[model samples]
Every structure is written in C-alpha cells, then in structure tokens.
Target: MIYAIGAVVGLIGGIKVYNKFSSGDPDTSKTAASWFGACIFLIVAATILRSFFL
Candidate 1:
C-alpha cells in the first residue's frame, strides 16, 4: 500500500515534469529522472510485496 502510494505520487510528479518540458516551461530533466526512478522503485517494491503477501 505504501509502495502503491509512492507510485501514484511518482506518476503525478512525472506528469508535471513532462508537461513542463513539453510546454516550453522548463527543462526539469532531473525531476523527471527522479520521478522515473521513484516510479520504478515503487513498482518493483509493490510487486515484491505482493509476491510475499499474496
């Protein structure tokens, strides 16, 4: 559940980063990268948690 929340937060952050970069607002490449990392981490964690719990 915590991992899922992390993923959702990461998704929202990534979307914000994408929108900024694509709209000529700012680069935000680092933020996007961090968000990507967070998303991947959460996904893996969630998968592992599920495997262990269910």
Candidate 2:
C-alpha cells in the first residue's frame, strides 16, 4: 500500500520534472531534488512506522 502510493507520487513528480525540463525552467533541478526528497522521505517514514508498530 505504501509502495503503491509512492509509485503514484513518483509518477506525478516525474511528469512535473519533465515538464519543467522541456520548458527550460531555471529551477528544474531544485524541483526535481525536492520531489526526490519527498519520495525518499515517504519511504523512510513508512519503514520506520512499520518497524515500530508491527
């Protein structure tokens, strides 16, 4: 379930980054980094919660 959510978020982020890249946006790298961080944070948080609760 958590992974499924992560996949969705990844797909959305990928599309957003691609758009930014195609448009030659100056902050594209920053956007990508933030999105990547969000995905990683989600995974890590889920893992920590599962380990603590289950």
Candidate 3:
C-alpha cells in the first residue's frame, strides 16, 4: 500500500512538473530536471522497496 501510494504521488508530481516546465521559460531547465528526477526517484524507490519486501 505504501509503495502504491508512493507511485501515485510520483505520477502526479511528474505531471505537475511537466506542466510547469511546458508553461514556463526555458531558463528553469535545471529546476525542472531536479523536480523530474525526484519524481522518477520516488517511483523507482517504491518499486525497489516493494520488490524487496513483498
């Protein structure tokens, strides 16, 4: 359940990040990259934890 929650959060976060980047100036590339990375990391971490424990 925790892992699923993490994935859902990540998915929603990633979509928001994408929208932010799309509607803003290109000068914020670094900020967008970090946010996108964080979303990916959350999903990956959740997958790893779930696989290890369940």
Top TM-score hit: 2
lDDT string, candidate 1, 1-54, tens digits: 777698679879977997888887756887787888888888888889889988
* TM-score computed on alpha carbons, candidate 1: 0.59
lDDT for every model? 0.82, 0.94, 0.71
* CA displacement after TM-score superposition, residue 49 of candidate 3 (Å): 0.0
Evaluated at residue 10, the lDDT of candidate 1 is 80
Please give, for residues 1-54, the per-residue lDDT of candidate 3 as tens digits.
Answer: 665766676777677667777888564667656767876777788789878988
Q: Which ten residues in a row have the lowest lDDT in candidate 3?
A: 25-34
By TM-score, rank the candidates, best first. Answer: 2, 1, 3
- Itemize residue pairs with steric clashes in candidate 2: none
Candidate number that wins on TM-score, 1 or 3 = 1
Off by over 4 Å in 1: 1-7, 19-27
Global local distance difference test of model 3:
0.71
Compare candidates 1 and 2 on TM-score and give the better one: 2
Best candidate (score: lDDT): 2
User: Can you write out model 2's per-residue Cα lDDT over 2-53, one digit (the tens) per residue?
Assistant: 8789889999999999999999999999999999998998899899999999
